[model samples]
Target: MQHALTKVGPDYDVVVLGAGAGGMSAAIFAAMEGARVLLVERTEYLGGTTSYSAATTWIPLTRHAQAMGADDSRDKVSGFLDRAVGNHSSKSVRDAFVAAGTGVVDALEDKTDVKFRARPFHPDYLYELEGATSFGRALEPLPFDASALGKDLHLIRPPIPEFTILGGLMVDRDDIAHLMRIGKSAKSTAYSARLIGHYYLDKIRQGRGTRLVMGNALIGRMLLAARKLGVTILTETEALAFTTGPDGVTGVTLRQKDTERQIHVTGGLILASGGFARHPTMRADKLPQPLPEFSPSAPGHTGTLHDLAFTAGAYHGDTAAQPCFWAPVSHRKRADGSMAVFPHFVFDRSKPGIISVGRDGRRFVNESTSYHLFVSAMYAANKDGSHVPTYLIADAAALKKYGMGMIRPGGANIAPYLADGYLTEAATLDELAGKLGIDAAGLNDSVARMNAYARSGTDADFARGTTVYEKANGDPTHGPNPTLGPLETAPYYAVKLWPGDIGSAIGLVGDENAQLLRRDGSAIPGLYACGNDLQSIMGGVYPGPGITVGPAIVFGAIAARHAARRAVAARKGDAA
Candidate 1:
């Protein structure tokens, strides 16, 4: 973390609320510019939903992509986004994110320990569209050793319980691949053994596994960078209101622990506090009809900052195609009396021998499409709410191999899941339809058509495996088509899928510089927002993996760059 400032801050030049991807990046970028910074998190943990994410940063034109031979350009991406996002968002603001994305990644890698590697094969979610490619564009954060965080390790939010295994071991893509090939290949066996061995050793030395992967690793790297930069971080701190001067926001009123105090700010107050996913008022107003009962987003984003920002003359963007990014989710009650809401983000739905149908027992959308599209399809099909709580039907063989929703793969004992009513099992297709209240004839016909598609390698009804992304997520070893298969095995299984918002898409409107905008279109001086706190540049369109985190880093950097420049000018003014 060279060239980063070691300045302590009583009167900080930049103060960022929220320790998620955007806020942490803003704090680090400003600190690297020698700006005294204060990073405040209401929760004790450093990462929000980002820590629970796969940390696939969707930034194009980065050196990682170039080195990996990614055939992409700014114009090509612009064209694709223009079609995909259209007039749903501010084109200029979206352009700003695209332009600054590569530079933001470069700055973090060059000036700090934060590092990212682009995968050789990652498709844009909408692969059928023109200007789309099968590889590059999506970058993933390198796995980090959490021990490097030392005593601050616990400050990182734990991964979703359903996502981790072996009592808390977080695994990467490679690790998962190896684990799946256990006993089938000698090399895979050895790799899996070593990985499991390390996890146990980590558990012995640390309460949790020290080998951080995915979102945890991304957050760990940033947390480490913030520490090295000497950015002041106060956790369990609640932001009450913004204290402003004639020029702009001058400070923030905070309740840290048991004490309430106001801190001075010399540059700006940055808002990256997740979104309104958990806010009751915002949910009622912004979310879709029937109002989803579950959400997989991090608990920290309660829209407190958005409300506070309203007092600072900030307004929310209303042009988005949708208010929140959605996912088809399934939930089950845990032994602890808490419900576990799991977003079905590409594990089972696309795999062989599975079909998602509305209550009418007919397929509604491409089963292998992106999670956002899947949920959007749910909403479209359930205009009257009857089609919602759709059923994901899978046979016993598929359930054992791919696992549906909260079910684990390769597990023979579905007794617990069945007993808890998380899964409904039946020995016959007609019996399964009856259990799920599906039309037996429609369900039977749909399954027969799917079986026909499996044999012919073509999805006549829904075009399941036609796109690059669909095939990429499907089981490659399967029949004529990877994502198409017959659901004829005995003892069928079903899980109820509900539309769950993964993150808020609508947020405070901001300029290209990441500065908040007023109702009359003037920039609100001294206030900036990024992450979900800022309106989604995609306008509720889930373009590719890491779309959220990618923009979070970019706009955070934009805000930091402007804030740091302002701080330098202010110092010159004071000196003169």
Candidate 2:
């Protein structure tokens, strides 16, 4: 049923599959080194799952941290990784990331418009771990104006609609605080006005807002850099299979629109496709127990490159204790029949007066834990499906103050959500428990215990606010233990939480040079894998905010440098 490729496309020195942060990094880096590069994406738009993320890059012992007076070193990072990642960690990869990461960041900032600033106060997930720092390791992309991309603005993937407000208006972490307090304070009102004014002005001119923040800004900057570097970006083009010669992989068979074409690559092939988050079979096989139904990854993240690589003799990494980064998500049916998933990372769970409960209506984990740890507890509690769909129960006061899931704070109208069945609300905790199919008496007892903790400022059950990590994400305005307030006010509200992944932790086995390895641990020539396509350096541990993306950009630069060198050597060999 396969059509023969009708034509041969022009050759390039290097070809990168997927136009995500990692892929874009590879393409730009290779092109910077004087390699003709082709960056191909199956989706019409650039940026993969990264376009929907916070876009924080967690590179340990970076110059940014040094500039911020953080006394982090490779030795300290190694100690932290040892404690966090345990025995299965890749030391060489970790070392490579630390060594090359700052250089890559600097390169991107110097050569392109992809600027970054240090989040000086961002805490690592396991802040109590040895060598973990409370500041200056994570780097966030600076907000970018999409107008810089000009006509190509439409090609950069937009942020998730669930993450945006007012259709297409984008906001950052600081801006969210402003919007939440828009009417309450003059400063907030001014911030909101300025944000909306800019949004409307951009909308009028280009039909979409130009001010991009977070992941959208990161991707937009990279796309602008790629275009500036004259990298050939092929959208809506999918790599079907690799064509090999006696030497190694020579080219790839591509499906472009209705036609199948062969595009040759002389240097190397870099696979930075955003892993298998959307691949059902892969998810079922790799993940523990019941597979996750919701993910924030792009639809193009269907393990296409993984499959192709496997067929070409690349070996998948050994399964980790946790095979994917976890999060709790609530979904709402959109007008177009698709679901809009909102990942509950911040803005609700760790706030005062909210607690997640299992079907038995008992707290199973510290509500202030990182989203990954929270879902890990969910997985552990899901032995008999009792915690498959845990409920994040909060009272009206909490809902009004901090919100829950997709619900806006400060008593925003929630009738639409209730009508759509995205949330369940009742006049009493027992009534809400009954509506959510949770044990009513158990729910009442748990709330009573929570209230006791709220008054005493101590979580006796799970020790919720015991750690600096937990307290960092908590409400500072709340008295005593900010993460341990009582869910005493009614009516009670509940959002159904299902297990979701940010990205796959399992990926192709690759060496320190970012070269894909075979079953026998031999490097596959001319093949490289970075980003989620390569096994996570943390061995599935979500140690910090940008763990997934930090290694991605670092290894992407490494892969490009290695590939470009190989290409140069090949050219010299040919000439000799």
Clashing pairs in 2: none
Off by over 4 Å in 2: 1-9, 183-185
Residues 208-242, model 1: lDDT tens digits:
89889999999999999999998888788888999
Worst 10 residues of 2 by lDDT: 1-10
Residue 97 alpha-carbon offset, candidate 2, angstroms: 1.1
TM-score, one value per model:
0.97, 0.97
TM-score of 1: 0.97
At residue 49, give the lDDT of candidate 2. 84
Determine the backbone clash count of candidate 1.
0
Q: Which stretches of candidate 1 lie over 4 Å from their true place?
A: 1-10
Give lDDT tens digits, candidate 2, residues 265-359: 87899998889767768877888777788876777788988888987799777746688889999998999998898899967888889999999
Q: Identify the candidate with maximal lDDT.
A: 1
